[model samples]
Target: MGGSGSGNRWRYGIKGTVDASKRLDIRYLKQHGMLRSGYYSLSWNRGGEPTGNINVRMVSGESMTVIGKWRRDASEEWQPMEKTVYLAHTACAYGGSRSWFVCPYCSRRVAVMIIDAGYVACRHCLKLTYASCNEDMIDRSWSKRDKYKAKMGGDKGLYLKPKGMHQRTWQRLRHQYYEAEMQGWQWAAERFPMIKDWM
Candidate 1:
C-alpha cells in the first residue's frame, strides 16, 4: 500500500513490486550510473515526464524524436545521449515482442532496473537483495495476523462490527482471524521465548 521500504513495516508474504516502466526512469537510471552523468536528453513519447532534471536539450516531432548533446559525465566532453529505445508491442502464438530499454552505461537492452536512493541501475550494478532475505516464517505469520486484525478493525476484538458487511460473513471472518492471530502468537513465541511479554 504505502512505501513499506525505507521504513519498518514488518513486511512478510509476497511483496508487491513497482511498475515495470518506473524502473526505467531516466533520472533513476542516471543516478544509479546506468547512464553516464552529463547534459543528457530524452526523446520518449510515453506521454509524461520523469521526475528528474538532467535534461539539457530535447527535440520532439511526429511519432519519434531524440534528446542529445549529453555526455558520459559532466566533467568529460559533451556527446550524444542514447535516447533511442525500442519497445516491441506486437505478439503472436510463438511469443510477443519484448519491451527493452538500453542501459546508457553498457548499451545492454533490459526490462527492469534496481532503483534506490534516487538512483537507478541494473541489478548487477546495485547488488540488491530480495525483500525476504531476512524473513522467517514466524514473523510472516505475525504479519498476516496483523493484516487480519487490521481488516477487522484493529487487534482489540473480533466481534466489533465492520461497517456494511453481512453479519454472518463478519462472524466467519472474525473466527478465522482469531485463529490466525493465535497461531501467529504461537509461531512468534517459538522463535523468541520472550514474545509472550508483548502479548
Candidate 2:
C-alpha cells in the first residue's frame, strides 16, 4: 500500500539491506521500478550495475521516496533511471548502400542485398515479411504498358529507362512497381513509435 504523496512510485525493502557498492542487474531494477519511463528496454547498451548512494525516505503516512542512478556500461554515460528505449532505424542490412529498398510485406527500408535472401525482414521486429519475388512477377506487373512505353519514346521501356526517369517520375514508378515493398516500409515507420535513441 502507498500514500497520496507517493504517486506512481514504489519503495522496496531490499534498498535498505543491500550494500550501495553492489551493482543491481537491470532485470532486477525493472522488477523494482528503478528505471523511469521513455526507455523501451534495459540493455547492456544503455544500462549497467547500480552505482552511487540511494535516497530513501519515508514521507507522511505510508509514502516514500527512493532515488538512485545506474552505472550504465554503454557508449553513452550512466542513465540515472530505467527508461524505455527503441531503435531509430532497423539494423537489417550488413553493409550500407545508396539505394534503400522497402520490403513489400513489412515496408522496412532494406538493403538491396537482402532481397537475394528468401525472406524479407524488419530490423526492429524480426518479422519475415514476404516469401520472395520472381522475374515473371516483375515482368508482368512492373513493366510499363505499350502506351507508356511509347510515351517515353517507342524505343524506351520501363526497365530500360529505370535510371533514366526523372527523380519525381522514378519515385512514383518505384512506388507503383513495389507497392507491397512501400507498404512494408510505411507500416514499420507508422506501427512503431519513434524513439529519440536506439536501444
Candidate 3:
C-alpha cells in the first residue's frame, strides 16, 4: 500500500492497514551483518513473484541510506528516492546491545519500518495495522489449529506426532488442537445455522 494525496501533505488514513511483509527490519539487518559500513540489496516477493527491491548503504551503527525507485501505481513513472534513517541502540539483558531504527517521521526507536510510496516509517507513524488484526474469532481459531498441526509436522486433518517429541507434550498439543478445531466449528455453526444440524 502506498501513501495517498499529492505534494508534501501525504495522507495515511488511520483506517487503512499496511502490509508488514514489505518492511526493513533492523534486527534482521543486524543479524545478517548488513548494519556494517557496506551496501546491500533488499528485495520482497509474493507467491514466488518479485514485488520490489531497494538498495541500502550502511554507515556502521550510525545510519543507513536507502536508495530505490518506486511508483505510486503502474500508470505512473518510477521515481528515484533516497532516505537516510538513523539508528538507536539499547543494552540487552545478558550482554551486548540491540539495534533499532530511528523512525524518520516520529523519531521513535522501532525494530521494523514499513516501506510504502517510496518512503519508510514506523507503523505507528503510518497509523497502520497488521492483517491479522482484522481477523475474526473463527479465523483465529482456524489459524491456531493449523499452527499446532503444522508444528506437529502434518497438514490439515492429518496431524502426526513428530519424531523425538515428548509424549506428554504431544498429547497436550493434540488436546489444544482439538479444542481450537471445536471452537472454529462452533463459531461456524453459529454463523451458519444450517451447518449445525449436519454436524
Candidate 4:
C-alpha cells in the first residue's frame, strides 16, 4: 500500500466529501465512469452510532449517472440517492454549454453533495466534518510525521533517511517531522499521562 510497484496513490487522491451529494463529471463519466468506485462501510465517525454500508452503481443512459444507496440503519433497507450528469446547451458568441448538477433544493450548480437527513444538499448544507476536525493540531502534526516516515520506509524510529531523495529536501522534511513530534509528546504528557505508554 505504499506507492511502490504494487502500490497506488488511490486513497490520497480522494477528496473528502461534504455530504452525500458528490458529482461525477459528464466527460469523465463517459470515459472512465466512476473513477474511484468501491464498496465501503461508513460509521459516520460518530460514537455509538449505527454503522452503514453504501453501494455505488454506474451505467450508461441519456448521459451518465451514479445511483447509490445508504442504509438507514444496520437492518439492510437502503435509501436511494443519485448523482446524474446534465448537459446544458447554450448559444453564445463563443458558443458553449455548461455541465453541472443543480441542488434540487437550491437550484445552484454543484459538483457533489452528501446525502444528509432530508437536506440531500452540499457539505455546507449538511455540515460535514473534515478528517482532522476531531483531532488537535498536535495530533495531526504527529500523524503527518508518521506518514512521512512510512513513505521513507522508516518504521517506529526516527533518523532514517529515504532512498533517492536529495539531502536538502530530506533535511527540510526531517526537521519539520521531529519538531511536530516533540510538540505532540509535550502536549500529550501534560494533558493525558496515560498516553505516555501508548506514545
Better of 1 and 3 by TM-score: 3
List of clashing residue pairs for candidate 1: 28-120, 32-120
- List ranges where model 1 is wrong by over 4 Å: 1-86, 90-112, 116-133, 155-157, 194-199
Q: What 10-residue stretch in candidate 1 is worst by lDDT?
A: 56-65
lDDT of 1 by residue, 1-199 (tens): 2221322235444433343222445445435543432344433333485432234222211111233353345687865433434322334468844334444455455555433333344544555445444445554555666776777778444757777767887777777776776876776676567977888
lDDT of each: 0.48, 0.34, 0.81, 0.51
Per-residue lDDT over 131-155 for candidate 2, one digit per residue giving the tens place of the 0 to 100 score: 2211122232223333344444444
Q: On TM-score, who's better, 2 or 3?
A: 3
> Which model is ahead, 2 or 4, in terms of lDDT?
4
C-alpha RMSD of each candidate structure in angstroms:
10.6, 24.2, 7.4, 11.1
Q: Measured by TM-score, how close is model 1 to the native structure? A: 0.43
Per-residue lDDT of candidate 3, residues 13-80 (tens digit): 43445664479988799789899999999999988999999999999989999999999899999999
Error of 2 at 179 (Å): 76
TM-score of each: 0.43, 0.16, 0.82, 0.53
Ranking by TM-score: 3, 4, 1, 2
Q: List candidate 4 segments past 4 Å from native.
A: 1-31, 34-71, 74-98, 117-119, 156-158, 193-199
Report RMSD for candidate 3. Answer: 7.4
The candidate maximizing TM-score is: 3
**Model 4 collision count:** 11
Better of 2 and 4 by TM-score: 4
